[model samples]
Target: MNTRFKQLLQLSAAALLVTSSSQALAWGQIGHRVTGEIAELYLDADTREKIAALFPNQSLAELSTQADSELSNPSEFWQQTWTWHFVTVPEGNEYSLDKHAPKEGDAYTALTSSTETLKDPKATVEEKRIALLFIVHLIGDLHQPLHSGNGTDRGGNDVKVEFFWQPSNLHRVWDSGIIDNQNLSYTELTKWLSQKITPQMASEWRTTDPKTWIKESIIIRDGIYPEEPKLTYDYQYQHIATIKQRLQQAGVRMAAYLNEVL
Candidate 1:
């Protein structure tokens, strides 16, 4: 092959890797970073200082996607953590920690455990580091309605659909399709979202409980499933507000949790 052809092939391979990897994750990088940015804005000075000490030079926005990045590694620990990004609760049934918890540890358990680890005074810096990263990422995951799934479709990953004439799935639509369609970087999206938050909205969203977050996702999930397998502009128009609302709630709640814990 010529040099140009080889370079083209390499680019194609890289694109394919990214596409496949994204299909398996929650909220995608942009969505997670957006959530992180919002949380960073709301974090109190003490919480920010504590987080800086743990991360040294990194900001929470930079660390927001670290859990997903770790998925690229082939370690056993990473394998075990694969399920921590979502939870499945079948339609018509309420989510109960005692009954619905996954054997492999889903997002709910992971978030709660990670928060505890961060709170522990004896936890090593490395342990706190991992826990904090998980908290940041999992909070974003918990907000994606599909992450708290109906249990029949693998969190909509199995429900293939065409979005704007492009092949996609219901889960992918919520995870990145809507956000990507906006064509904004994480910082831009954060600024836009920040401008909309009212004091009442902030007060209403600030909560430390992951279960409440999951329940809110469940309510949103109930209305989101399309009756058909094709989605386009109308679908985006109908659901975009919910997406923005969830992102804002995730950010506020994450900041609340971090502030209380730290």
Candidate 2:
């Protein structure tokens, strides 16, 4: 093979690796965007105006994938934030911000810190901009049950499974498998979820603390693991409601958080 051809192949392989590995960390692009779009609907006029000013050329839905997009870029800052996409709480144990915090920081700390940054008047526009994007993405990540990992199995990334006869893992299955299978665009999913949210549901979901988000995820995470690693129609049927509910909650909570800070 020619040297240039070999190099091209090597780069393509590297890109594929990065894409697959990153998929395990959070809800996939469509899921995150759907959450962002839902949050956009709930934002108060003042909050929406401030966000528009902070991100002049972009919307929250557009910025929703920025944190994941940064993963492909090599830098100390991105490397240090590698762990912030998910939090690990072992099965049978509860998630506590004080006790369960990762040494490198996790989703909870990142969300809390980002919230403070956006709320601080002294924070620069650039600081608030980055914090807002991260907050948007991390809230979606926190809603993915697998993102609040069980101590073993790297958030189920190690639990090899076949999603609809294709080779995949439990984490990837939850991250995008079910949602992707439906073939809905982010906007379509957002619209569908919006119609389902009742006034009472919105009020209740909006008031939930982050700790409750994690705890609810942990409960859902526990019940989701299949006895066998092979997942098919039955698994999707059973867990689809949980997936929708989490997405809805993530969206409502995100709006609530932004309303408080912005």
User: Cα RMSDs of all predictions?
Assistant: 9.5, 8.6
Q: 1-262 in candidate 1: lDDT tens per residue?
A: 1232223223332222231133337778888888898998889999999999988878777888888876765544554677888888887877788888877778987877777778878666666777788899999999999999998999998999999999999999999999999999989998999789999999988888788888888999999989998899899999999999888888888899899989
Mind sharing the TM-score for model 1? 0.90
For this target, which candidate reaches the highest lDDT against the unseen true structure? Answer: 1
TM-scores of the models, in the order given? 0.90, 0.89
RMSD of 2: 8.6
Top candidate (TM-score): 1
Which regions of candidate 1 deviate over 4 angstroms? 1-24
**Residue pairs whose backbone atoms clash in candidate 2:** none
Model 2 misplacement above 4 A: 1-24
Q: lDDT per residue, candidate 2, 153-227, as tens digits? A: 999989999999999999999889999999999999999999999999999898647788888899999998899
Error of 2 at 33 (Å): 0.4
